[model samples]
Target: MSYITGFLTPVKTENKERYIESARKSWPLFQGYGATAQIENWGVDVPDGKVTSFPMAVKLEDGEAVVFSWLVWPDKKTADDAWARMQEDPAMANMDMPFDGKRMMWGGFETIFQN
Candidate 1:
């Protein structure tokens, strides 16, 4: 079974290119540390909710778009190890984020069903 790290981030609409480039730049870092793949999806038709929604969770603002991303790992141990090692990676430290990190939310998920 594979492990996954899911992420939700609100990036400024204008920074979409920068965001994609940032992800492209970081792919090697994650792959080097055991991530099998990285996927970043830019929201196309995300809707606002009255009570709670993707926008609400991230306190999305005008001129911003939501990014749904994930990293696929072989398993939990590999994922955990990669996370621990990434913190000390100099390249990661130097990587500039295109969005507000404080609003980003992430979690590790155990795949329940996959074909």
Candidate 2:
């Protein structure tokens, strides 16, 4: 089964273009590292929650929007290895992060089911 690396980020609404560009620039690196696929989604109609929500989880600000993204890898080992090496790749090191790293959350998930 494939492995998944998911991300939830809070980015300035005005930086949407830069956000997409950053992802576009990073896609090749992920692919070179064995990622099979990648997806990036911009918030459209995300709602606020009374107790807990995507926005609340990231402490989203007034001018920021939440971005949901994921990358698919052949398996956990490939994903892990990719991540370890990606940290040292000069291309990755030089790519600009459009959003605040401190406000981003990510995790690797084992796929239980997928069509």
Question: Cα deviation in Å at residue 23, candidate 1?
Answer: 0.5
lDDT value, residue 96 of candidate 2: 92
lDDT of 1 by residue, 1-115 (tens): 8999999999999999999999999999999999999999999988999989999988999999999999999999999999999999899999979998899999999998999
Query: What C-alpha lDDT does candidate 1 achieve relative to the native structure?
Result: 0.95
- Model 2 over residues 35-115: C-alpha lDDT tens digits? 999999999888999999999988999999999999999999999999999888899889999998898999999999888
All candidates' TM-scores? 0.98, 0.97
Q: Rate the local accuracy (lDDT) of all candidates.
A: 0.95, 0.94
Q: Which stretches of candidate 2 lie over 4 Å from their true place?
A: none
Worst 10 residues of 2 by lDDT: 86-95
Most accurate candidate by lDDT? 1
